[model samples]
Target: MAVPVVTGRHARLVRVTHALTTLCFLALVITGAEIIISHPRFYWGEVGNVNTPSLFDIPIPASRPWVNTGYGFVMPDQNGWSRSLHFQMAWLLVFTAFIYGTWGLRTGHFQRIASYYNTAQRRTYLLVIFALMPFMIWTGLAMSPAIVGTFPFLVTLLGGHQSARTLHFFTTLALLLFIAGHVVMVIRTGFRSNVRAITVGGDTQA
Candidate 1:
């Protein structure tokens, strides 16, 4: 009997991981937005506050009463719930990433990189996978008191806690742009087929 060959679809683990990651990321984006609105200022160095000079402002009213956004009234503070949800989703994303990474490494799945991505997609994605994502994760961890307390070097390397926070915001923006471009590419290539491939997959010969 001839062994069946799977074609067109990504690995089952990859597809499942991709789906989970997407959901987690979408949730994170929503929660992150709310968190930012609580204080839309970016800062630098180890310490910063409303009193200190902000590196930049988002040009929108803050959601917190203490932020002093120069608006007539403060928006309701969704920070508590949003931050809690954001942390939960971020950890879930990290878990998925760990599984996907380990599986890929163990199976040498990354050896098939060229087959899964085009030249442009490969380049852009490799940058995200290897560089930007790591940077974002590092900065995020650096900003956490618990994380910094244990791994002081993480914060030191980044120069300060506030620096990490500022950098994380920019990293999020870069990821958003990448996500938008990825969506556009999928639509241009064939939205339905692409979705099918990522989910149930495309045609396969057995």
Candidate 2:
């Protein structure tokens, strides 16, 4: 089979969206890791606090002087900084995603891909772009207290804020795995040609 090459306005838009998504996702993941380390536990339902029985716990070492037990190892609680960056990047992701989705649909980008690519590849792309991404966005919003307060039904639909948080974490893991697999596929198909088509926006004979 001939390797697929992306070009023209569609290629340009895809490249831009891919870059923005990568940067924003990386920021979110780093910030999310820092935030999770502080609590290091997962729960469910509307209410979960320090006293609540955790569904699962990660053994993150305590850092605060009062909580320290001679062991120096600790995960820094950077929620204040991380949370701010996380939300900012999240908004950026949402905006870029909207642009990409709208343009792709209007330009028949999805149709072209579906026609050109094999069934497996087409299905994977559709699943990632349509199904998984929307679910991730929904779960992310559901976890936000402010968002949930404004639209209480969001959290209720997800079972609860904690449930949304749990789903978000797992969804993130799945996305990471998808990214890894995508990279491998690109390498196997035609790395140099793929990179040039995406970066330079021109016809590439793969």
Among all candidates shown, the one with the greatest TM-score? 1
Checking candidate 2 for backbone clashes, the offending pairs are none
What ranges in model 2 sit over 4 Å off? 1-10, 62-72, 203-206
lDDT per residue, candidate 1, 67-183, as tens digits?
A: 887885787788899989988988998899899878876775665564566788878877887788788789889989998999999999887999999888899999999999989
TM-score of candidate 1 relative to the true fold:
0.90
Winning model by lDDT:
1
Superposed on all Cα atoms, the candidates' RMSDs to the truth, in angstroms, are 3.2, 4.3
Candidate 1 scores a C-alpha RMSD against the true structure in Å of 3.2
The list of candidate 1 runs beyond 4 A from truth reads 1-7, 204-206
Backbone atom clashes (below 3 Å) for every candidate = 0, 0
Worst 10 residues of 1 by lDDT: 1-10
TM-score of each model, paired residue for residue: 0.90, 0.84
